[model samples]
Target: MISKYQQLRAQALPHNRATLMALLKKHGIQSLSVFYSGSGSTGDTDKITATPPEAVARLADVTVSLHQAKVEVLAGVAAHALIAEKKPALEALREFTLAWVEQTHCCWANRDGGSGDVTFNVAQDTCRLKHTEYYTGSLHHEYSL
Candidate 1:
């Protein structure tokens, strides 16, 4: 049976890929890599680390660096949405990586803690998803009183 995450992944994966491809094409970014890490009991801190650090810095403001360019998701909204959202910053690149990890690796990838990197080779039209799950353990002890 398909679960909610499966259903969402089925619908979201293609769209997310398409969106990312379009953005890359628009900016002439032949290849890109997005690094994501999430760790928390309830998946509280999840984020996409700027590959070169300057990639996103450049995206934030075109004037910051000539190599870095900004891609506006919506006219009035934040410009970083192309790479990350505002509230949780998990939309474009973030969503693509984290969502895939959660769907394929572990639905609790973030909740239980995991980290990975996704590399996109546009010219080859391929993407690599690599991740490692952290150790999660609990002790159950009971005594009759």
Candidate 2:
């Protein structure tokens, strides 16, 4: 008896990296993950994994996510693998992360014509959007408010 989420993830298994990314974008899913598994002699036994981003997206410190330490996350990591790509799904996530970071700017109605910069680490799966301080000499500020 497969759950609905399991079915959805199963459907994604046959698709390539590009299609997975497109589905993420289409679903407005903010985050996704792709990890690898196995190092056996078969040489073809290694597997890649994909997970829902929000599964790790809350109350995260600058250094790590407590959610990632769960037993379930470690399990089933190799049960389903995606179709191989010339570029791994990790790279697809990088491109998606870059584009996702680009659209998160807010600098149109600043009285001082303020601007901002985006720093995103695909490997760390983190994004920071820092905006210039209001009426300050381009001093950047943080905090999501």
Candidate 3:
């Protein structure tokens, strides 16, 4: 029998990216990631901007999570294929991850915040893929909270 995680993952798959962005926006989140670099000596001022096309693409492929509901999803991924061999590392990750999810979801308290989060971990030979989201808004409290 399929586990509850599998079922919820299936349901959350369709709206992963969009759902993440929506939640992030509602919580006044401006950037998904931030970075810093240093120069050896004197450095010239630099300006950074987000490209429209890139922004759209990034938004198109984000992870989704509903913290209040204790659910997480990854869109367009094959979960079973991931654990075909049941490697020790994968199994350990799975155990820790599920436990973490259980704790977070069980204690989530943003009911009226319309806040939620989701993450997607895409499998790769070298390193597994991963994405995460957190959103806050009025809807979070009304339904899933």
- Residue 5: error of model 3 in Å? 4.2
Tell me each candidate's TM-score: 0.57, 0.22, 0.21
Best by TM-score: 1
For residues 107-128, could you state the per-residue lDDT of candidate 1 as single tens digits?
5545567777887777777778
Estimate the TM-score for candidate 2.
0.22
Best candidate per lDDT, number?
Answer: 1
Sort order, lDDT high to low: 1, 2, 3
| Per-model CA lDDT versus the true structure | 0.56, 0.35, 0.32
Q: Model 3 misses residue 32 by how many Å?
A: 1.8
Consecutive 10-residue window with the lowest summed lDDT within model 2: 62-71
lDDT of 3: 0.32
lDDT of 3 by residue, 1-145 (tens): 8566655544443343344345445434443321111123211112211222244234333433432223335696434321212223222223333333333443222332112222321221111122232344454345564
lDDT of 2 by residue, 71-97 (tens): 233554533332333333344444333
Predicted candidate 3, C-alpha RMSD: 19.0
lDDT of 1 at 64: 13
**Clashes in each model (backbone N, CA, C under 3 Å)?**
0, 0, 10
Global local distance difference test of model 1: 0.56
User: Which one wins by TM-score: 1 or 3?
Assistant: 1
